[model samples]
Target: MYYDLMQTGLVGELLITGDNDGLKKVCLIKGKNDFIIPSDWIRDEVLFSDVKEQLGQYFKGNLKEFDIRLTPEGTCFQKLVWDALTEIPLGTTVTYADIAKMIGRPKAERAVGGAIGANPILIIIPCHRVIGSSGKLTGFSSGLENKVLLLEHEGMEIKGSERSALVM
Candidate 1:
């Protein structure tokens, strides 16, 4: 059976879901109706204790990498993109094209973007670390503001009058 938990975070409220195997989702709740929890899911704080703790440490700048096992659901290509995202160093950012190359599909930047957009486990998967080719902040499932916050929290400088450019 799937278990879930609600935890307040830096970006917003996070809905964490998983089972005994590993975590399945770590979605940011933007509004009341942003996500619908499955009826079969049960609320279990005990199951997500480690997740909460690690996330708290990450937000406080005490942790750089997560040790939790994740089992996000997605197509094989999407999983490949997400795996590459995990390889991104904590304080560095890469373009979508970089991810495409990392997965051996150097010409599939747009496809990589789509897969990155579909990532279910946000911070843990490190999708926020992907930027545009011009070093500009790009789309993030949680929004660009949160993306900047995360990057800055990791010690990356964000420049540009619109707060859309990265100094990497």
Candidate 2:
């Protein structure tokens, strides 16, 4: 689990070392702004390169789905939660508690939130789509503002009660 710290063409970027596939996935959320990714986790490769190119296109409203594979690390329950995240449609959204129930860990809503927060792959894992049970966006290791922007970029309606509104 490593990430490269680089500000490519996006607001903020993270290049994650694919632990399972050797295929790094670059994450560009919230139009690419405001974050902290462990710089020591970087592995130099063209995987992240392709990911960056596609992410740029995706953010610019030119591309929809990303053709990237991920090998994010986590617990069995967490993996279940993250996998559920990937099933979320490109432009749709889901909540942490919702994810909890979906993974058959209904009482683990808080646990689900924990796993969502622990998500290492960001965009590809779709952690940004997991909002608060109240329909409010919350707790992205990448930041809440970035979460909102990602939702909007995916054409979400902002849920009306959104707080920061892209606090960049």
On lDDT, the candidate that comes out on top is: 1
Question: Which predicted model would earn the best TM-score?
Answer: 1
* Candidate 2 lDDT (Cα, 0 to 1): 0.66
lDDT of 1 by residue, 72-158 (tens): 889999989988998998999889988999999999999999999999998999998988898888888788888888888899988
What's the true lDDT of residue 55 in model 1? 90
Clash counts for the predictions, in order: 0, 4
Collision pairs in model 1: none
The lDDT values for all models are 0.86, 0.66
Residue-level lDDT of model 2, residues 38-96, one tens digit each, is: 56655555535666676667778787666777665568887788788878878877777
Worst lDDT 10-window in candidate 1: 1-10
